[model samples]
Target: MIYDFILVGHGLAGGILARTLSEQGYKLAVFDTFKANSASRVAAGLINPLAGKRFAKSWLAEKLVPFAIAFYQQIEKEFNVKIWQPLPIFKFFSSVEEQNTWMGKSSNPAIQEFIKQVHLRLPFSESINQDFGAIEIAQSGYVDVNKFLDCLLVALAQSHLLIQEFFEFSRLNLNADFITYKQDNNTITARKIVFCEGFQAINNPYFSWLPFSLNKGEVLDIKVDNLPAECIYNKAVYVLPFGTDGFKVGATYNWREINEQPSAEALTELTERAGQILKKRFVVTKQAAGIRPAVKDRRPLMGWHPVHHQIGIFNGMGSKGVMMAPYLAHNFVANLQGAKLEPEADISRFLKYFTGI
Candidate 1:
């Protein structure tokens, strides 16, 4: 039987895309080995609209945030599993200048949509150090990425839609209308193959030409006392509230050493930064590292292979996969059905690099 789509890599992107296509009445098979230290497994699952030191709104945040929230909530209702948790982000102001800048930008209608409140005097002064005060960002939260992926994989496995193995490029045979691959004693066929292999895409012969700027990031989970559990606290480093008395601190970016091993330098950096923010005693509980599948221009990669029309990619989500995957997955499916992809994300932008074209 020829499946409508065969997805490679069941990480965040592939999982969401598989669900999107399946709900649209497409038969699909997912290929994955569930590798450890994958970006999806190590992601903090933040959904912040405002990003960077300047606090500019994320690309397409107005549309992506609402759509993502609805999509995750719908999945929860259908599966009866808890994954999406909405929480506010308290962005601490580093200096009076930063506070003034925010004060000025808060009046804009676009920025106002995400601003819950702006404080001149530090809020939660007893526990946090925000001398210049902070701004509470609305419509912010995190997804329990591990739980979501695990639940989805289980359902897929039960339905015989998941193939727990790596996809070997040499075994794939592409025809004019469909593609076939040899797996053990069986031959699996699919009309189209979409690769969502994350940073590992760099090794894929077809899609490797796409400019990938991968980065390794490390996050630490800690148990702390007296820090507020109501919201995520952020300054230089983010202290995300987890279970009772626990917080996930992290994310040191290291582009030089792009591997999945946690480093002592990153651990020290995270703990020290977290210490400056949370004045209470804390104990490190866990440390994780993963490589983000970032692009040079910092946008998702989507679209068909320039020469191989049957091949496609839906990857390079970087740190925003939790928020971007759902909406982007829907959009990608729409593109497959004759709609246009968002130009910035379309791999067509790099068509010149594809020698096959």
Candidate 2:
């Protein structure tokens, strides 16, 4: 085979998989059709140890967090670029009722080590609506996703390992030894073809029955010249800085699954939420909507196709792609190398009845 693996998409999942395999000395090629509103592209790339208004500990944070930090660091060293920045998330408190609830749950031990209650002013207090001050989430930050991908893309191009095209299903041909694709008017062979098509994979004929519900997400890119330059601001709506004089403010979820364009209503709603969080209004520079590849059970989809020996999938990280990709990719690669399945994220759990295991 000319390549040991052919990876589709350069989103979090595909990037993680390709990099991991390449580190193990596997020959690889990545094909990606750039879309403006792709989830990872629009994402604030926020990672928090605890989640929700009630502040519950994130699922598998102890394991996932360390793995993510180390993995991104390794990639950064290789590319000679800095992408992951660990900034505190200042979660401001609103109503008195909400403050009471938070105070009561502060000692739950679920988030004890990660949460720090604060009455002092954070840097955002100067430009934010920090009514009752806030608790700083020590283990929260945002990833510079676009920049990370940019560095990776350049590196891949230099290595002659990337392609940019909408991978067509019609070109996929499976044989005993390799999976081949008629790409860029040339025939290419790979030991295995892994699909990271994101939300579009719901329509893939082979794996359509996996039960995925796509959610359209709308996010805003607003320029705020007077805001704090350090740490992400997470109140009702998260405000993440994306370098330069801009901040990425998002996001409203519309579970209806229409992803044609950014809805005016959604844009208005996002702006309204931002106004509530920020002390002053900012310019809405850009608005976009992308359908998240959300799965029914809300876990990532990884591992081999049920019947196709050389075909596979690595997707469904959903809104948590930035936080989940490295950990899940490690598991998937281990499984592909004939190691035992890790208990949590194996795709076989979902296909148990279908596979009769």
Candidate 3:
């Protein structure tokens, strides 16, 4: 049978894209091995509109946030599962000057949309230390990534649309009108194939030249007493409320050592940073690490190969996959249907890398 599309890697990008395309009435199949320590599984799935110390609005936050929320809600209704958790982000200020900086930006109309409230004094002084006050950000929350992906894979499996195995590049055969791959005793043919293999794309001979800047990030799950579970707390590091007394804290970035192995140094760093805001003692429950598929230019990578138009890529979402994938998937599907790809995200920007093409 000829499929409309074959997606490689069932991580966040591939999963969302496959679901998006399938809903649009496209015949498709997904190839993946459900590898452990993948970014999609390890990610906290944060959706924050304001980024950085200055609290500047994220690129295209106005559009991406609303679209993502609605998309996830639709997915929840379709799957009858709970994944999208809408919670506010309590961004604590470390200094008076930092608070002043936010006060200056809060008046801007664009920034005001994401700001819930500005607390001049410590809001939760008992469990938290807020000497310089904090800002409550609206339109922020987290997706239950593990639950979402697991549910997606199950739905795909039930429909016989998922091939649970490692994709072999050597077995792939691409043609002008279609592509074929040998799996076991049978061959699968599809009109187009998209590689969504996260950081592992660096090893892919076809799209490896796309300037991937991969980084390793580690996160920890801990049980803290008396910490507010009503919202996510952020200071040096973010302390995300989990179950009753549990909070997911993390994320230390390391570009030098890009592997999935959890290190002691990262554990210390995370605990110490989380300690700054979480004054209460906590017990470490779990630690995990994964590599982010980031790009040098800090934008998603999408578009067909310069020469092999039958081959395409939709990756490099970095840490913002939860907030960006659904909307990007919609746009990518639109591009496949004849619309122009978003210029910044279009791989055409790096056409120079495809030297011999």
Candidate 4:
């Protein structure tokens, strides 16, 4: 069957692109294996305006956060599911100096909206050891990514738009304007093909040459009584409440030995770190690992293939996929329709590598 687009991978990137394309009345099909450790499936889906050790505003935070909130809220309404949780992220300061730095940052008009207040001490929980107090961020929350993706998957299947199979690069045939995929007993042709394969793109013959410094991250699902369920608690790691009693504590970023397998060393590290902050006892119930599709410059990769104009990619969102995907996906859709995306995100920045110059 002829289609407008064929998307490879059904992670956050693929899912967002699919939603955008389908909303625009484009006939698109998705091919995915739904790997357990796929980046999107394993993400805690935190959408924070201020990030990193310095607690500076995230790149394009002003644009990405609002779009993400609206996008996820829209999806929630369409799917009739509770996915977007507009909660706050309470970042604990390790020292007085850091707390003072946050106080100064909160005064900036550009960042004031996101900073609810810088706390001198966490009033609710003595279990958390924030000597220098914490800063409660406004308009920050975690997305129920798994639930969101599951609902989308079902909806796509109901509409015959999802194919639960691994994409084979060898079976893909690209032309000047269209591409064809030869599967087991059927062939699907599309005007354009976009790869949103996450870290697996490193193995994709088409995009493998792109600079990808993938990192392995591990998280543990634990039940901690003292931690409040209302807001995300962040220190060395984040304690994101999943339900009334369960919290997701993560994550260890390992540059080497990157894989989906959860490691014992990481488990030990997390438990120890969590212990330092929590005065209450917690039990590790489950562990998960996934490779983040990060890049050297920490910007997303989007745009059509330099040589194969009909081929494109929407990936390299890294840990911020929860916030970045929706907005970037919208921009990507616009670019596909003859508009231009942000210069930094456009894959054309690396066109020199593709051109052998």
Candidate 5:
């Protein structure tokens, strides 16, 4: 029996796509191996409207953040699970000049709604070094990715829509109408097979040529006493409140070290950075590393293969997956149903790469 779609990789992209398609009344199957080092597994799942050192609003943040909140809230109500933590993000200024820069940008119409408060003196004064103060951003929060994924997996399993296995590209056969995959003795056919593999896509023969700027990130879980638990703190690295008195400190970016193993050098670097910014004492509990599926142009990649019309790709979300996935997934499925997609996200933007310009 042929299905509407066969989704590969059950990370954020795959999960969202699967759910979006299923909700649209399409018969679909999802393939996932549940790798430990996948970006979604290690990501803090931050949804920040205003981000980065420049304190500029994220691309399409106004639309994406609200869509994500509504989407996750709907998921929570349907699944009876707790995963999203809606809270403000406290971005600290490195110097008075940086504070002035923030104040200048705060008046911009695009950024006004997300600015909850500007503090000359931070709320948490004792446990943090805030010489230049911090700004509390509204409509910012984090999604516990592990919990969210677990909830999705359980829902998919109950319906027998999830396949727990690795996808081998060698056994794939692409046809004009459908794509067939030979798994052991059984065969499965689908109208379209979408690859949602994260950084692993770097090795996918079908998508390997799509310029991917894979970056490795290291994060730490720590227990900090006397640290404020009300909001996410961003200085050198982000300090997110986790369990009781627990915080997640991260992350160090390394374009060279894309391996899964946590590096000692990264740990030291994070420790020093956290120490310089955090006045509270903390103990490291865990360390993790994951490779980000970033693109050279910093936009998501979505569209069919130039030659294989039956095969498609939806990836390259980078760090903004938490905020962008819901809206993008909705729009992606819309594109499949005859609506045009934004050119920035459409792989057609890079057709020159495949068409031999």
Candidate 6:
């Protein structure tokens, strides 16, 4: 079989990239291993407007948020699915100095537009220590990535473009012109191969040299009687309402040990941290862990392979895949369609590894 492009992995990067390329009228095929541990399935898909304890604006929030908002809305209408939700993160404040620092930064015209002047009074039915008010960060939300993947795979399958088997790395044949993979009696070929392997890319032969400071994130699923059903509550960890009687609370970002298994230590940490935040006691419903494809530089990595131009990558989204994928994917598809590349995400800047820059 032949296609204009073949995408490996069906997680956020692969799914969104495929959609963008398809929208631009590109003929593509997608191969997915459907690994249960892929970060997309385990993610809570929170899109935060601010980052760190001082409540600084996330990178490119002014531009990325608007694009993501419109993009998800269009997808919902086109596919008739509830993929995005507007959920405010009540960014927890720990110290008066920290609060004052943030308050000062919020006044900066550069960031003030994203941050609002408030007395720090926000409603929380549960009890959380708030000497100063929490910042009600707006234009922040989540995507039901799992649901989006399911619907997108089905949609692509209907078009005869999705294959469910795991992509075997040993069988991959990469050259300057094409990439091919074979399993059982079938073989697939395409002019270009892009690996959106998420954290698994830590093992990709081409991108291993990139500084991927991987971290393990663990989250909890719990059912409560009547918690804040609309807001994402935060103290040390975030309590995200998942509809019905349950909420998804997480996450512990640990760099010391990176593996795809939920640990009891994480469960205790999250539950205890959450217990201190919530006024009522909640039951732990589920626990899962996945490694984030985080980079030390903390940016999405997009570019053709250093040697093999026919190969490419769209990983290193870290925890912001929901927020970053649409914006970057659009650019990625555009570059493939004869558009110039964005400087920050362009991976060729690592010319030290290239034989020729």
Candidate 5 local lDDT, residue 169: 80
Q: Per-prediction RMSD in angstroms?
A: 1.2, 2.6, 1.2, 1.6, 1.6, 2.3
Error of 2 at 217 (Å): 1.1
Candidate 1 vs candidate 6: the lDDT winner is: 1
* Steric clash pairs (candidate 5): none
Q: Where does model 1 exceed 4 Å of error?
A: none
Scored against the true structure, residue 40 in model 5 reaches a CA lDDT of: 91
Q: Tell me which residue pairs clash in candidate 1.
A: none
lDDT of 5 by residue, 1-357 (tens): 888899998889889888888898888888999787788999988888987767788888888899999999999899898788988988888888888877887888989999998876765578888878888899998998888988888888876467888888888888878888898978888899899999889888877779889998989999887777888988878888986768888888899977899999999999888887788788999999998998999899988888887788999999889888899999989987799876788888887677331
- How many clashes in each candidate? 0, 0, 0, 0, 0, 1
lDDT score at residue 260, model 4, on the 0-100 scale: 85
Q: What is the lDDT of every predicted structure here?
A: 0.90, 0.79, 0.89, 0.87, 0.86, 0.80
Taking all chains together, the TM-score of candidate 1 against the true structure is: 0.97
Between candidates 3 and 4, the TM-score winner: 3
> What clash count does candidate 4 reach?
0
Write candidate 6's Cα lDDT for 1-357 as tens digits. Answer: 578888888788888888888877777878887766678899998887776655677888887888988988888998898988888777666667767766776777766665544445545445455555676677877888788888888878877478777766798887667777776787787899888988878788777767778899998999878665777877778888885678888889999998898999999999998886777878898899998988887888898887788888988888888888999999998897689767777787665655542
Considering lDDT, where higher is better, how would the candidates rank from best to worst?
1, 3, 4, 5, 6, 2
lDDT of 2 by residue, 1-357 (tens): 489899888887887787777767888889987776788888888888877656677778777877898887887887788888888887877866667777777777767777766544434456888776777788667788888878777777876577877778899888888888886668888889888888888877766767777888888888987787687777768888877789988778788756758898998888888888888669998887888998877777887777886878889888888888888788778777688655556666767535321
lDDT of 3 by residue, 107-136 (tens): 999889999998777744778878788899
User: Higher-TM-score candidate among 2 and 4?
Assistant: 4
- Pairs of colliding residues, candidate 6: 120-133
| Lowest-sum lDDT 10-residue window in model 6 | 116-125
TM-score per candidate, chains pooled? 0.97, 0.91, 0.97, 0.96, 0.96, 0.92
Model 6 score (lDDT): 0.80
